[model samples]
Target: MPIYQLGQINTAALQTPGLYVQVVPPRTRIINGVPTDVYGQVGVASWGPVNSATLVGSPTDAQNFFGVQQVRKYDLATAIAIGLQLGAANQRIVRVTDGTDVAASVALKDTLGTPVTGATLTAIYTGTVGNTLQATITAGTQQNTFKLTILRPNFTPEVFDGISGSGATFWANLVSAVNNGLSGIRGPSQLAVATIGTSITAPNTTNTYTFAGGTDGAGGVTDSTLVGVDGTSTARKGMYALRGTGVQVLNLVDLTDSTQWPNISTFASGEGVYGFTQGPVGASYSTVSTSLNTAGVDDWHMKVLVGDWVYWNDTVNTQNRLLAPATFLAAQCAAQAPHVSTLNKRLGNITGTQRVAQNQPYSGAEIGAIVGARLDVISNPSPGGSYYAGQTGRNSSSDPTRNGDNYTRMTNFLALTLASAFGYVIGQNQTMDLRREAKSAIESFLLTLQQQKMIGDVNGGPAFSVQLNAENNPDARVAAGYMQADVQVKYLSVIFYFLVNLEGGQTVTVQVSSKPR
Candidate 1:
């Protein structure tokens, strides 16, 4: 007998086989759950590429990429800082601009006795942060040569040396050095780009140049800019840039335009993103609720907040700033597990809210109006009391069944997880074994979710059931290359009210057991 492995030979034709060791691989696949904590924030910033998604891990990372929080509207860094403060990590930040941004530039003069222009250096990114860049030219160790040093705050200086040339050649060499960079000594300049103008002689001493005329272009930014275009991959803009970034939760920093709610809701629905938005700053509950209703913002995927814009200590800007409720609510929701509801969860790093700062809390009627509108808010003296927490974690849905934060988020989480894990089964052979394997994979995932308490039993019944067999995939459907799966999951509900029934002392008899009472 010859040694053989599974799939290497047909066993029925192996009449001369010596030792057949067939290794059968496991067919049942384990579906891993997708992360529900990554957050996506889209807004204006002082620095960073526009319409591009960049992952930032901490407040410092956000500042490093997008600049520090500014005392202006539509500030992306401020929103990211707020999210980080509330324990949200793994954020995808996308910057937006008004399309009027200009890069900072400076002209170096040629040593033509009268000193004609030699080269112009411009920042690569179009923002005011480029204005802070400084370039210096100093005599190099090689005779009649110069060294170029580019500097920016909180970054390593890029230096290019060993310059030697004449006339236009000198400027070309310098430009090439800054643009194409040296092979080993240094890489391309991160602060600026250089274009050759005219040649210059080596400076006798050091001279520093500061960039000017850079514009942030944030002044003219409107709601449309933040909503952005979902053009082709290379032309995608604003929040659309976050596509395929796997950001489970998202928000447009301080976006209050009621007209764009449907657009954002559509994007969220299509992208499987759970989004947060807020009413206008200092807007009354009636105004917010009416505006939401009129705007047709009733999607379970979008959570709209009201009456909880907070006064945050803007330590970066050294001022008190009013932040949107979505900033805190979205971050808290992103930080939580998918099954955990945002209801009554304490907010972090908040100084005061509009209600708290004004010594005004929502009355029963006001809360009723807000909840009746299916909007959520962060306020003090919540069910948790004293500390600020999400007071009624409702999404903007008229349907009461899908209004809860847990319902929306858990559904998205489970659905996305299944969709993400089941794609591998598409091209497999249409056999009962394949169907069984697919069924087992889905059942295994649901079992994991149930064991983790993400889903739960209802009245002693199983938390979920999945059907992916010949019964669901009948002869007609299977002949047409259609495989069907029927799944039903019971999500654990949030406890909005804990009611107690009490009987009169004189009429009721109390029973006590010695075990604990």
Candidate 2:
């Protein structure tokens, strides 16, 4: 027998049962509302208590104690605990009512004449009234009854009045007068004042007064006041304006300094005014004054231009600093002439001899041309027409000399013309062919600059190439590849190729290469 041929077999270990037990002592009862002492033993058969016992044992011993006698005990603590549990499990019921005006001393009772307990009540008291009593009940038999009674308050309202009279009567009369005066005063212009009496009366004999019509008699006024005693001290006369039915009275108490009054000078005419005139040309003292008053003439004086001709002191003065309309027009025409001849002397050029042909006349077209030429020269003189023409000036209104209209038109024309001229110049200078070549050169130079900056070079050396290819061509592709390994030329490498279909077509062959960086 060969002993070396035997091999031993092994098995895994078996698991043991894990069983355990715990015993807790049964609760004891209270004696006279105090806890009572009880004894318990865990080993064989030891037990002495006045309460119930709990026993748990191994499966083999469980049957022996299954029929053992058990008892439960109770005291004050046990009774309270049981009562609480019963109350929590029982259903609750409630009732509510408004007791706004009930008396505080009333005793509440249920149907069985039993006083209810454990009840809640709420009361809301308002108005000029006193407090009230509110009651609630929570008895099992009478849960639906309620009572309420109101108490009187101790306050009352009082009317207010001043030295004038009762406030209510005064206010009533005032409102009536204001309503009746609406036709004369219009809207709310009449002051409202109430009187204590049924009708308003004028002041008494001791008071002095003035009347609306400047009259001085007693019977002439509808309602009047006693003015004074006669010369013989026999009779009294009315001196104040009468107060009558529906007559408005102002209360001095409410008067202030800001009251409005009628203006007396609403349409008065005076100096320092301007309007149409219909009189002699030069009248120092005429029935109607000149429309251009003192103020107007003063303003004209301040605005007079130098070298203006004017008529002053009944004589015309050339070279005056103030010019009326006629004189201003004459001066303008004279300015268009060429030159002034010397008076009573050796020969000289006559006026208008050397005047520019374009500005010699005062016609509309001539004026327009002269003004346009002047503006072009001063504001937008483009040297030899190389620079674009910006806005020189414009005539905005029928009256071309109006300052605001002229300024606005000039500004608009300037902006529009400048933009148009700029576009024209750019189109003429930057042709399509030159722009294309320039763009290509700029792209190449940027790429070279980026290379010199070593932005993407792995070896910290200048190496770059321009990439060129048709954007949408699928079969034909070209790329310029350059590296610092070849140092002869730093220009971009050029790679170009085309795809062609062969006869009896076969698989295509792709070509790629590298050149200078």
Model 2 per-residue lDDT tens digits across residues 60-113 = 122122211111110111111111221211111000001122211222222233
lDDT of 1 by residue, 1-517 (tens): 4444546787778676377787776887999988899899999887888899998988768866788788888899899988888889889999999989899998887545677768899988888888998888887778878788888888778889877676678778889999989778688887788987755454424467889889888999987888899988889998899988888898998899989989999999888899898888888777888888898878999998884688888887899888888888899999999888898898867878888788888887777878898888788888867888888888888898998988878888888888898787687668888788888998999998888888986566789899988678889999898999999999988898899997777868888888952
Which run of 10 residues does model 2 get worst, by summed lDDT?
Answer: 259-268
Best model per TM-score: 1
TM-score, cand. 1 vs. native:
0.92
Question: Candidate 2: which stretches are off by over 4 Å?
Answer: 1-176, 179-517
lDDT of each: 0.85, 0.20
Number of clashes in model 2?
A: 10
